[model samples]
Target: MKDQTIEDWSREDLKNQWLCWIDTIDPKVSLKEGDSVVFPKKRIVVQAEMTPLVKSIFARWERLSPSERFSAWEQLKEATKEAMKDVLPSCIQCGECCRKGSPVLRVEDLELLRTEKIPWSALYTIRSGEPVTSHDKGEVFFLVDERIKFREKEGSRECLFLDSTSSLCTIYEDRPLECRAQACWDQSGYLELENQPYLTRRDLFSHIEVLWDIIEAHRSRCGFERLYGLVKKLKESTAQREAEEIASKIIDLTSYESHFRSFMAEQLNIPFDILDLVFGRPLERLLELFGYRIRIEKDTKFIEIITQEGPFHEEA
Candidate 1:
């Protein structure tokens, strides 16, 4: 077969090519002579940097004229819908889809989740700061919005609803619209995915914005951004006493806990585990970056933020 240039390709061809490029490396997919692709087998890692070539492709789309863009979209949508008309694709039950990642739950799916078959524990939220691959932009970054999604197995990429032995959905009948929209035989299902409505933090937490506003206010006042500078200064100081004093002043654990607990309980009205994901784990990890280990004693409700090499204080 003769190699076809991207300039000669139709909009639908480009869309399908982009899909395959992101999904997996396949020889069947069309590409320029030297296009390099990365196939991430797990959830999109936040740290992956976009190459200049990928950035250029994104810029090209942004510069498209209205009429030119409309023509392209029309072709893209018609091709996707047409993939379903001829014959419904057959599923060999390979379980690749489940292994790739769990589906993001739609708002309508949240309503059905009230049923006994689908417990709330089976879900997980990818909050605003979590990273996910953008199907359109082909880049990964901290998401601008909170997304409710089905949980994956504890240490595996397979969806929680997928039965390992059978390669079938445990909650097949009660699966979300996103799951229903996927078809093993056709790429169209994945292409048309943006049409589905996703559930956000605001849908479940009525006053989350209030908590966010307070958190933002605290962030501005707290100087969390200066953490790295404090760490660097501590590393350079000759006196251990001075370093300890600086560390204590830099991390106001008391102030953070008091304000955070108040905002979580009174303002946000969210569960404790939600707070752990949204604030606790992140804060703990941040401290770890500065050579501190955080240990929470559940029995006595104590928090110990200690240095890796020296004596530390405990709080209750």
Candidate 2:
């Protein structure tokens, strides 16, 4: 085949060529301060100083307009055809995560699974608005409110679509978004492990932090409105008066219990756990610090805040 000139190549052609060039360079080449290489086959040029050349290309690419970026990418590709194949590393499929019950399905995933006729059991109960639990040990699925029971004995622990014998997904073409979005070991060295193909808690926590930011933004927009509606329903019910009275008594007991524990702790200088044995939660400590005084009247729960000026009442 006749070699194509870089000047006559398309943007995609140039990119492919550049990637090919980068892939072909010997790791032992030891790129130095001043050196250059020319690929006559691809009709492209590359410099010896790896750091400066890469930095310049990336910086210039960042400053380009979207259309110009495409042009520059093509130019880079034409300049480095040997690097194209090195874009992503290979994956050795072990399917450990698939077998170990790590498949996380969002609500949208249900539609896909239903369409595919995948045999997966729903983990939640709609009644009581709480997660169902195992008959043996009452542990709820924290996020899903579903019990953690598997579909069949074999399919229960493994991903519904995973084929154990082949170590491949049966529904590879129609897998859920989570499966498609996951790029394990892309940045971290976790994928390098022979036994472990999963991310650790630290990596998962970092992902959760990013998700929390998104949740916080959404909450700022509409969380209060939803809470207000719930509160309003609680306030209007016939059981509202009884509930408020119970809530008031509980609050006062909680407040006094908190203060009493703190007083004991300060006087004895013991660890908070000892106090926790007597009284649960930081709310007790908080009540002591704030000097909580609560009073219930008719259907209203009142909180009296003691200030230096005087005491003031607030109704819930």
Model 1: how far is 121 from its true place, Å? 1.8
Q: Give me the candidate number with maximum TM-score.
A: 1
Considering summed lDDT, which 10 consecutive residues are worst modelled in model 2? 307-316
Best by lDDT: 1
**Cα lDDT over the full model 2:** 0.39
* Model 2 lDDT tens row, 1-316: 1486544455445446555656675432212344322222211222311234444555565355667655666555543433322222333344544554434334445556447454333221121122223211334432222111212123255664567687676767666544554432231232222233222122222355643453243334323233233333434447857656644654554555446556656755546543322222233222322334455589654655443331111100
RMSD of 1: 16.6
Q: Which stretches of candidate 1 lie above 4 Å from their native place?
A: 1-88, 135-138, 207-316
